[model samples]
Target: MIRVVLAEDQAMVRGAFAQLLDLQPDVTVVATAGDGDEALAAVAEHRPDVLLTDIEMPGRTGLDVAQELQGEQTRVLIITTFARSGYLRRAMDAGVAGYVLKDAPIAELVSALRRVHAGERVVAPELAMAAWDSADPLTPRERELLQEVTTGASNADIAVRLNLAEGTVRNYLSTAMAKLGARNRSEAANTARERGWL
Candidate 1:
């Protein structure tokens, strides 16, 4: 049997996934975790063949957890609600073997798990297309500034929040806007959000 570890912050979602996997003839849910730290601990304790995790969780992000645990014994599969291109890119960089959307059909998820267990890469095709088409080449600092702007904060407010000078914030915002091809701050925010950049 393919031993699986499930890690999701939402109680209902975690239970549902566990139950679904448990019903599969060739798979078993050996461990379940509600956060990134627990997920890592479970992996160490259970040493499951595959780890299915949500990207955003308390304590440590899924990317961090995956980066830490990815190895010959355990394959990492990231499951997320937000199909952010940046998150996917980071997960891929962390050597995640599979990336599945939370809303994807259970069959797809099962296939993804099986593929990853067999040392194959799995990424949701739709998400892959969207990510490819909407790629925004934002530097880390520019992305951070864009995220701050998404809160509808004034320039001074963002400066204080990010501990950056107002002029520096303006420069970052301008750079982000230019990269996103947006005409104004509001437009930039909207564009970034639409592309899942913020």
Candidate 2:
């Protein structure tokens, strides 16, 4: 059997995925988790052949779990709502076995899981093209600041959270804006998010 562990924040989605995978003759839903940290625990305990996870979660992201489990036996397949090129790039960089969007056909998702479990890389074609077309432009700190901005944090709040001077925060924001050609902070945040930099 191809044992699988699924991680998604939404309970309904998680349950639906579990039920669907469980119905496959060769695949078994060995465990399910509601967040990244729980997913990690499930992986450790079950040591499943495949990990199907959403990229965004409350405790840890699927990307974070993939990074943590790098080079291990468990293969990771990221399924997320966001199909940003940046996220695809990050998943590939972290050595995830597959990356697919949530809106993809269920058959494709099932096939991706099997392919990934069989030691093949599976990336959505459109996302792959987008990832190839756009390179990550933001510095690590700049991306960090953008992430904070995405959470609706003010410049002062970001400065305090990141332990930077308010002026330094502004400088980073400005640099990111220039690099991304954003008109303002909100625009910068939106741009970064769309690019998956945040």
Candidate 3:
């Protein structure tokens, strides 16, 4: 049997996932966690072969949990409601074996588990498209600037937050706008939000 651990903040969602996975003939729900800290603890205690987790939860994020548990012995499958492109990129970078949207049919979950177990990478098709559409080679400074701008900060505010001169902040923003093909700061912010790059 494929031993599985489920981690989700919502009780109903957790229960539904547990029930769905349990119904699989070759799978077993070994444990369940209501938060990231509990998810890590459950993985340590149960040593399940696979962990299915939601991205946002109390204590630690699912990405944090995945970073902690990534290894040969156990695999992580991220299940999230929001299909944020940045989240998907970060999850992939964290070495999660699978990514599934919460609203995906149960069959997708089962197939993801099977694929992860078989040493295959799995991501939602829509998410894959979003990733492809949003792909841009961003410098580290540009990424940081974009993140700061997403918080609704003014140029001076961003400079203060990043401990840079206001002129430097403006320069960074201009460069970022050029790279993203945005006409202004607001447009740049909107583009980043749409791509989930923030």
Using Cα atoms with residue i matched to residue i, what is each candidate's TM-score against the true structure?
0.80, 0.92, 0.77
Model 2: runs farther than 4 Å from truth? none
Candidate 1, 107-189: lDDT as tens digits: 98999999999999999987787778766688878877777777788989999988989999999888888888899887888
| Worst lDDT 10-window in candidate 2 | 189-198
Model 1 residue 72 lDDT score:
51
Local accuracy of candidate 2 as per-residue lDDT tens digits, 1-198: 999999999999999999988889999999999999999999999999999999989978999999999989999999998879999989988889999999988899999999999899999998999898999899999999988998899999999998999999999999999999999988998998887877
Error of 2 at 18 (Å): 1.2
Candidate 2 vs candidate 3: the lDDT winner is: 2
Task: List residue ranges in candidate 3 displaced over 4 A.
Answer: 58-60, 83-86, 152-157, 181-187
TM-score leaderboard ranking = 2, 1, 3
Runs in model 1 with CA error above 4 Å? Answer: 70-72, 147-166, 181-194
Count of backbone clashes, every candidate in sequence: 0, 0, 0
Compose the digit string of candidate 3's lDDT tens values, residues 1-198: 899999999999899889988989999999999999999999999998899999889989899899887674889999998887877887887899999898888888899999998889999999988877767556678778877887788889999988999999899889889978999987887787565555
User: Model 3 misses residue 93 by how many Å?
Assistant: 2.0
lDDT of each: 0.87, 0.93, 0.87
RMSD values for the candidates in order, in angstroms, are 3.0, 1.6, 3.1
Clashes of 2: 0
lDDT of candidate model 1 versus the reference: 0.87
Q: What is the lDDT for 116 in model 2?
A: 96
Q: Which candidate's lDDT is highest?
A: 2
